[model samples]
Target: MKYDFDEVIDRHNTFSMKWDCREIHVILGITPRFDEDTIPIHTADMDFRCCEPIQRALRAVTDHNIYGYTGVFPGGYGQTYYDAVIGWFKRRHDWDIKAEEIVYANGTMEAIRSCIEAFTEPGDGIMITRPVYTPFTGTILKTRREVVNSPLVDREGNGFYEVDYEDFEAKAALPSTKMFLLCSPQNPTGRIFTDEELLKMAEICRRHDVLIVADEIHGDLIRRGNVFHPIAKVAGPEGIITCTALNKTFNIAGLQATNIVIQDPALLDTYRKNANFVLPNPFTAAATVAAYNEGEEWLEQLIDYLDDNIDFVIDFFREHMPKVKIRRPEGTYILWMDFRDYGLTGDEIRERIYEKANVMLESGPQFDPERGEGFERMCVPTRRSLLKEALERIAAQFPEG
Candidate 1:
């Protein structure tokens, strides 16, 4: 590998949300019983360094020492930024995108909120699969929209999951259901929606006049043998809005850059009008251009390392903690672990990890109380040594397993 993914830089004083356990607990409402040095394997951000190209670009910007307001659309370096975005989709995802169809937002979540606000009305229903990324449900509730959860079937023996199409269609057919937020290569479960699945979902939404919001933020991190089918390609552009960002791929999330793609002109006009308050950051724009143009090789290497780390975690669990089960992930660095065999409630698992193991992991219920219980989300984008330490700590506490 050309890049050093094993290198660990100190993030303690960097105001990292993951490293700051006290703050994370306060935000997530997990009161800590004991405080000690803890390794945070929670949150989606990686422990690895940002791609070299992006770091160099940010350093160059800092060296210039002249930070002032800069234009973002077709002015100065803005066109280059836009072209990078277009070129990336064509090169990576095979989706041809136009400049006018792309709108800039500060981040994926911010863009999602804007879409919820623009496309759906208060008290309207937004459809999602349970044991999904928590923020999907949180954003819905925050916007005063009702959350319509279509729970995925467990496929128990293999630890894999599948959508219950029957239930999904039933929810979409509802009169108040206005939109569906599809998390491709979905969080927690890590199942990449196949093209057939995508088409089926598109069919249901179209018949019910529901708009589809595809959150493909983790699309590029897909594992080997799995294909990430972009919803717009199957559903057509008429009622689809796709959100993506370089933050996850290149690890430049602190820069706050995301692209919200809308193919329909009339819908684009409405979304932009509703999200009019968004402003572009000059440094982040520069970093984004650098990432798209020069960071592909680094990204490729990072994915390889992340895949290896996932394997390590799975092997460790199977050998030492057989009671705990994991379904091999198809995309994203986050691994979903099922601990139902341990006979522990979600809070009990959280307590053991936080109080005894001294590691911070995302509790199951935070994703969905019913479906997410007895499951934990572990971020595995760190060095193998650190990852092993976290696993060892947890295994030591559950020795009988």
Candidate 2:
């Protein structure tokens, strides 16, 4: 309990997309039925304060006030940030890493989009597991590449989304399939792929000469007892392209800093060439270095608090909202709650929350084009008091048919 995670901070008037339902509604072409007073749990971003180390780093950069072009490869703290990544892998997963193998990114999603641009040509097949982060699908499709969804299977009671290996292998086996975008500690159902699963996936990709674009963005936020096995470690010598960012782990999403690790030299060369003028965000870079170097203690505390929040929420649902089934995620603060038991469509759920509850949550239909229709993703990173209040708002509208 070194840090008080329950500190309530005012996020309104800060231009946060989460707090403004009207802004989202206007942009997305939906009518804003919810008022300005609604509490939003739609955005994937956290509500925690930035770590002191990150704030210091950003402040140091602003202290200079020289916001100009920065193209230098060896920017301030680049070496330190790289070193921190190496140490993190060593301490957490016992994996050895070399500094030269990784490259910086504005963000994981941007890196993923650039990877699509760099590694493959237009019309190439970029495979992904559905019920994934929404932007991932668009990242591929936006690049003029095809989004081939190898949807994950949820065996009525297993909770986490499991892939059909035969289907995955079949997709990789295709001549058009060039890359597989794997979301570890996956969004929505929050399935952390085991080492055995990684190996099996690696085997398929390797045999088919397909590249694996592993998005381990939520890797560091993993829960206890669940081991996050990085795909590159098991993909033989041709390790998968890893896309990770410090934004999610440290609640610095606005900082937009990430590291894309490509073990193969040829692939690395291709990606670096693709992102010709793209530079690692300067302020973001500085903050990432500081956070990685001095923010481990903060991270440990944050994870512990989040774990408690996860447990509390799970218990709350089991007791008061038993109709809403949640698959306890092994990672990430975003909890995927299945509301199919209520027999409400996605639109119905959205309307009910906005009209009756005054609470806004992310509709599942946005994640996977299939099962996303009947689910909702709730972010549990805010203060427990706020969460309790939001749930109470919904409780007032309980027993809705």
Candidate 3:
């Protein structure tokens, strides 16, 4: 069955965090005065519907109508769930994973917090790349750990970013730095680290005794012709805790199911002890089983549509708003845009985009307090027509001189 990627779904009254939540914007320092006509392209989740198989799985669960306590323990659903996860990774990424290595979590952030508690002490430094996902910083700080930032250097002065290896080694070597929170196929910037890069970073952490927590939720969302290597695959599984989830890939984040892969027994035991006991949601279990086993066709088609949407934005910006620098992302549906050429403060840019243009965008400073000025992260997973309209509205706000 062919899916319609062009269909525009109305998400206004569905309690969507991206659409209905105006107070969240105000809390995040964005203007909250958008009317009903406003378009939001900030949140990372897609506006697309889940695949037919996943929908069918959820309906089956609903039909059962038994919402009792459930789990993926041993018999019954356990083997099926594990087999789906293992098969998906083996087939898609060529990385073989064992059933024993998989641990369940409510969400990726929750898993990260548990890792922090289980591994590091309070006041220990957790390293991250700036102009990164804001939640990484928030999670580290909220866990009472110091945030050691190794800012990604855009050496070309274009939007492309490279790891400053020398700086990374220096931070890892710090006695206070106990862990490295890595974002593979990194967020916002969208650069998938090469094997050599991954190995170098992993080696540094191993030598410095820094625990490595790799967030690989975006592993399967690579743009065409690009590949994403699981850091655990590149840098051996020891001392590495890999976070994987079908939520991002299958557009089922609200279901809140995440798989934390720990190949080392010691690390796995420690994580389990510290991590909250996440009782499996029946709907999430059904969704994951179907998604991993049968949703590949839909995923491939979705990627093609997403790829076109990305190119459309790149072309639209180049033609209409040339000063707004953007490059095609190698992975993820996010586009990290540089707005420094306009010479406006981040707040001014946000005001114009939110108030005048009435299009909601994630402001740069939310990702990085210092270097993220005059930048914005746009999530481009909506219908192409709506995306074009949003871009045109934004272009009207910032006229080309």
* Poorly placed runs, candidate 1 (over 4 Å): 31-36
Q: List the residue pairs that clash in candidate 3.
A: none
Question: Quick one: best TM-score, which candidate?
Answer: 3
Query: Between 1 and 2, whose TM-score is larger?
Result: 1
Once model 2 is optimally superposed onto the true structure by TM-score, how far is the C-alpha of residue 107 displaced, in angstroms? 0.8
- Model 2 RMSD, rounded to 1 decimal: 2.1
Please name the candidate that would achieve the greatest lDDT relative to the true structure.
Answer: 3
Which residue pairs in candidate 1 have backbone atoms (N, alpha carbon, C) closer than 3 angstroms, thus clashing? none
lDDT of each: 0.85, 0.79, 0.90
RMSD of each: 1.6, 2.1, 1.1
TM-score-based ranking, best first?
3, 1, 2
Clashes of each: 0, 2, 0
lDDT, model 1, position 401: 71
Question: Per-residue lDDT tens digits of candidate 1, residues 338-369?
Answer: 89899977778888887789887888888777
Task: Point out where model 3 deviates above 4 Å.
Answer: none
Q: Relative to the unseen true structure, what is the C-alpha lDDT of residue 256 in candidate 3, on a scale of 0 to 100?
A: 81
